[model samples]
Target chain A: MGAEFYHSVHLDVELCKGCINCIKRCPTQAIRVQHGKAKIIKEYCIDCGECIRICPHHAKSATYDSIDILKKYEYTVALPAPSLYAQFNNLDDIDIVLSALKSFGFDDTYEVSAAAEMVSEMSRNYIKKHREDAPFISTACPTVVRLIRVRFPNLLDHLLPFAAPVELAAQIAVKNAMEKSGLPREKIGIIFISPCPAKVTACKDPIGNTYSEVDGVIAIKDIYPLLLPHMKSVASDPEKCSVSGRIGVGWGNSGGESAGLLTDNYLAADGIENVIRVLEDLEDQKFGDLEFIELGACNGGCVGGVLCVENPYVAQSKLKKLCKYLPISRNHLGDEVPQGALFETEIEYEPVYKIGKNLAESLALMARIDELCKKFPGLDCGSCGAPTCRALAEDIARGFAREGDCIPLLKESILSLSETISPNQ
Target chain B: MEKNIKLSYIVSPNDFLSAGAVSEDVKAHLEEMEIDSEIIRKATLAIYESELNMIIHANGGIIDIEITPDSLNVEAADNGPGIPDIEQAMEPGFTTLKPNSDMKAKGIGKGRGLSNIRKCTDFFDIETELGCGTTIRFGIDLK
Candidate 1:
């Protein structure tokens, strides 16, 4: 909970032009332009990295874990997301990527995609047994889960109760490393190679879960530059790298999870704006027969993440080709659910931004703002330092700005006062 | 009430793309005013259902909104074909629009719109004159 305030995404004030581009693009309306710079209201932000992608000035950036962070632990294991495979073009072998990760001073590499397959299998049975009126929403994307918590509080019950693939893989990696090296659990560091800022925030301040098993999060963009030097020469043993089923590798792209379910009656949407619209439809109970609804905040799933190097379309194509070639998983962890990794705790709504402290004050404020909205122009031109005309009205009601702050209103008042003071002058 | 704010909008017919513009506007206004989150959500859902009904069923309609200290009120009047039996229409899963038809393909007339609107608001009322038009009034109390 304390780590929610420590967002990986940050704005460089010197580079911001205050053009209102980010203010308009943010899905949560967490950004505001003030004093010729943009400010992020920490509580409202879900760290989806939408502003990072839309900012033309490149003022917003995702922070990555420095290489030095791995020095503390005796054993360091790299748990790479499947999106990492989509980063390099024409990469035929999974061992090449795993070996390249080992060259970066890691003891072993674990495939998060393997864990993804297990999760998909678990979800198929969960949806079958615990049926509800609404479709079960996938909790794979941390940003999407947080969106449900903030916007659709009533639909929290609809989310599938299971740990994300990355979380499960991190715990598994740590356990395996401790067994192999005969070291204490605290000595093993399981670092996740994440494709988005949301994963970084999730690792630090996990939602629903008590604590995150992962120790550090390094952005995929940061590792891409370092791995280019090692991809040319790799280990010969293919068994050293973790390889999973084709369905798991396909999870890097949108609709991949739904396809794994083998169910025709499902809905899949990508991108934050599109996800919001789909959630609204789901709230209306339009897709009554839908067994699952897979939503990713990125445009083309993790391949289109803000912190990734490759283009989403090109990466999606590569991911598909790789999925077609990979063999299915033979190893099975039969019906037993992992003890610490299961999502057993109930997740409560995080109403970070409420109108007022109490009921009466909120009602009074609403009445005051309604009265002020009538005076402002309804065009929402954004001429008065606010994103919309209604925002300016709220500003006036909150006593943050004067009503005359509007340029048009100020001019009209001045012209009327001059005429009234001197007749026919 | 010490003060009252009134807003009116004209919903264009068959503009499936822009059907939710009015509801979105009202939701934004409620958000800016720092209204209760629960109340805003209920009002927005009711307005959204009303807007979709006006656009899909009726050719077009006039949406009149009134926001006061006590409650948020919306009155939608459409000149479309009015329902002969109000009781049956109010029942959930009683959609007149056929599946995969023109209107259903556009994702409207789910038969849950009226029932959903009724569930979201504290006060719900509808009056219709068979072949003339239909008028629906609903309010969600902020208090």
Candidate 2:
């Protein structure tokens, strides 16, 4: 792994209490409390925002472009994610939101859900054509893709070789903006109204593709308040701006992407933990003859992102209600899948968790870790700053820590030393 | 320097909930050693299938695992009722599970345990005696 790996989720040193909450909750074990503060190993982090969601002190925050970014370009397009539709009280019409986006200072508005429908169509055809490689994992969630890239090496071939809907939407939005406004590509900003920090990192440092078309990413939470008043003003005479239908809007909730594929053989799992379990089972070939695997790092897909404002279940129901009267699908692709929609680069696995540089060194390190583990108590108390006792042993074996770091073992040694030196009292 | 790591686990009888715990532990170790992903998958699958067999059929068992730079070796031994027909038991879909057993409800006994173990390992052997017990041994080459 190189120093080029970028992470959007960062810690606020002022607010951190150096608690073990983040270290324990990180699915990748990327975080560790050292010297009374949490340090995130950049190579190990997937920018999944688990620390952001778990931090009780509000010390963790995601980096994204502010609303002021609209002024940087002559023409700006707001690409609203489907989860953005689920944030309002009674948003029966998607046009109201789209019109408000225009009122919110963007020159034009594009729905990411529209591109999602196209991706769904492309995936269905891909699955049918690649029957030998039946179970393709969804790459819509950047967190899931990064997780697979670092952890699950055996399942790399199964990743759907397509750009995320937001990426495709940005490309189309930029192309349309340049043609309509008679401006150069740089002058037209393709901004994404994102639901999570993973998308921000994905745009900045793309994995499957060489570069992302998205110029800037703004969080839904930051844009929620500004759009509300605009939404209220446009509700009465909203422009007919919604281009997507039920299948597209359904992408907001868990299992929504799989549902759009129109297949009962697919399996959809949400939340990072559940996604890891499914990937592990898939590696062992546990699920027989599945067509597709949809994984969301958040609890209820994009709605449960740490950057979103509404409760995920509430947003899910609202999304269902909003899509109730809409058509099955409004967007349709041609007989051939578009070239721009596919990934241009291959995603290679990064063995960040490997204990050493090679097999011989790794064996030596593993043996030393095992030896250290035997000396330390098997209590997985995070007092040593590591998540588990075994993790502490690994840290010791790597020379990043020492056995004296174990508070319990250190206490015992100190007590014995005092007892031996004091003589019989 | 060459070093061989050894591990052991005692599988409790009918403990369906925690049956795969040993295999998960072994898999974690292999992951730390940076073993090839395919090899880790095969090793874990074979261990998991053998563990399930001990819990579902044999009255618990003891599993011993040895890992070296070149290979992974496992021996699962149990003193439960021996297999009456070795040939039939090795066949796919050949299970002694009752139609309405508790294991069936939990989706455990699919009759693919032994066959899957054999399929995942490079070397596999089984020994059984009518009045005694059954022991299964398997190995996968890491190189």
Candidate 3:
């Protein structure tokens, strides 16, 4: 909660027409309208890019490394997310995409799907071994992981304590670049062509892992325009591209990883709100039959990322079509997790609910808020600029707003006060 | 204590979608009051479990909550079919509903709710009457 690293989603203050749209849409309740502007509460923010998607004024934008940032390293390797393959039409061959990345100035392109395969294999083994009472949750989506830390802190132990596919991809890319180019580790950079902002935040300031091998993150949308013409041109020799099997590339959509796990009783939920409900059920121990749960913050999965150019459903169908072309006999990366690669770091819960400095004061404030809540209409109209009726109650209790601020309540009070002041008596 | 705060919620039966709404509201209230994190977690978990039980098993009842500087108390009263044996119901794996019963069909009854509620609260009690209803009263000391 201190001076942390950069968040993926930030407000373009100049363009912000603070309409309170993002505040209402935010699943984490991280956005607040203050002084006619929207501000993100960094402690509760998971960098899910929901604000970027919901912002009507185009005020919210995700930050990513430009192609210029990749120039600093002598050998820059681009790890294209599987979602990137689904971005183009009539491009069944993923090599064209890889080749397009190379033409876009990356020294080489590595398939992140391969790393995803490795991660999936390792996860299956882990799930089998760690057969505890609680179901194991996937860690591939950084936003979901952070959501657990923020909202569902009780279920933190259930999260699969593995490095994200992006991290694994970065590590492999860096290692491969160093081995092939004979460049020092510092001289080689691994840039992840991400479908979402969460990956960028993960690289900038890793949550679970102490250190990240990923040097930079570039959104797929940023690289898509440049790669379109290249993709249309001569396709790369399919032999040169490092391809992954159906299981790995299928991760762009929901239930893809669960299918790879080969588990009969696994639950998969996509989109931030849906994932939240699923996690609530998990918290209630409602999914007693399930052994694993896969949650993706985006609607369809990474393909539904705010930064993606393609429709999630279209991208999903394209990825599925490409999945059929994968050879029956495919290469699988060994689950050789680099030393110190696993996320052993303790992620503390966000303290958003803390009300008072001391127990006595907090109890008093809680009582006050409850009292205030009873007086206000429970309409949750959000007319008072608060997200909910309860929020307005807290605002009034905390002296940030007033009872008169509620338009309906103010009208009622005005009528009553006028009646009392009238000379009818 | 400046003023003892009280709240009442009428939880609807079979309303699975909004089963935990009351507990979430309580959590938000306690959070706004800045209660201790550990205490808040215990209270919210206990409240949520109790709320779920009322919705899934009972004929949807009312929950009354009273908060003081010293302790927080929640009394959930439901007019559904009462438990035949309170002791058995308190067990971790004991549930009145059959394995394929209505509640179990919806994945609601894991037989862990009552035990979890007991474990999370400092004080727990269940009062039930045959052919009548059940009332669960629990309290957690803020101190």
Per-residue CA lDDT of model 3 for B41-76, tens digit only, reads: 888889998888888888899999988878899999
Clashes of each: 0, 0, 2
Query: Which digits, one per residue and each the tens of the lDDT, describe model 1 over residues B88-115?
Result: 9899978888777877665566688899
Instruction: Write candidate 2's Cα lDDT for B1-143 as tens digits.
Output: 66778889999998888978989999988887768898999899999999988888888989999888888999999867999999899999988888888778777777998898999999999999886779999999987
Q: Is the docking of candidate 3 incorrect, acceptable, medium or high quality?
A: medium
Clashing pairs in 1: none
| Reference-based lDDT, each prediction | 0.81, 0.90, 0.81
**DockQ, every prediction:** 0.30, 0.69, 0.50
Candidate number that wins on DockQ, 1 or 3: 3
TM-score of 3: 0.88
What's the C-alpha lDDT at position A291 in model 1?
83
TM-score of chain B of 3: 0.93
TM-score per model over all chains: 0.88, 0.97, 0.88
| Segments of candidate 3 deviating more than 4 angstroms | A1-5, A236-239, A328-336, A396-405, A410-425, B1-3, B11-18, B27-60, B80-121, B126-134, B141-143
lDDT of each residue in A61-138, candidate 3, tens digit only? 998888787879999999999999998887778878887778767899788888888788788778888787548888
TM-score between candidate 2 chain A and the true chain A: 0.98
Off by over 4 Å in 1: A1-5, A235-239, A358-360, A378-385, A395-425, B1-5, B26-49, B56-59, B67-72, B80-101, B104-124, B129-132, B139-143
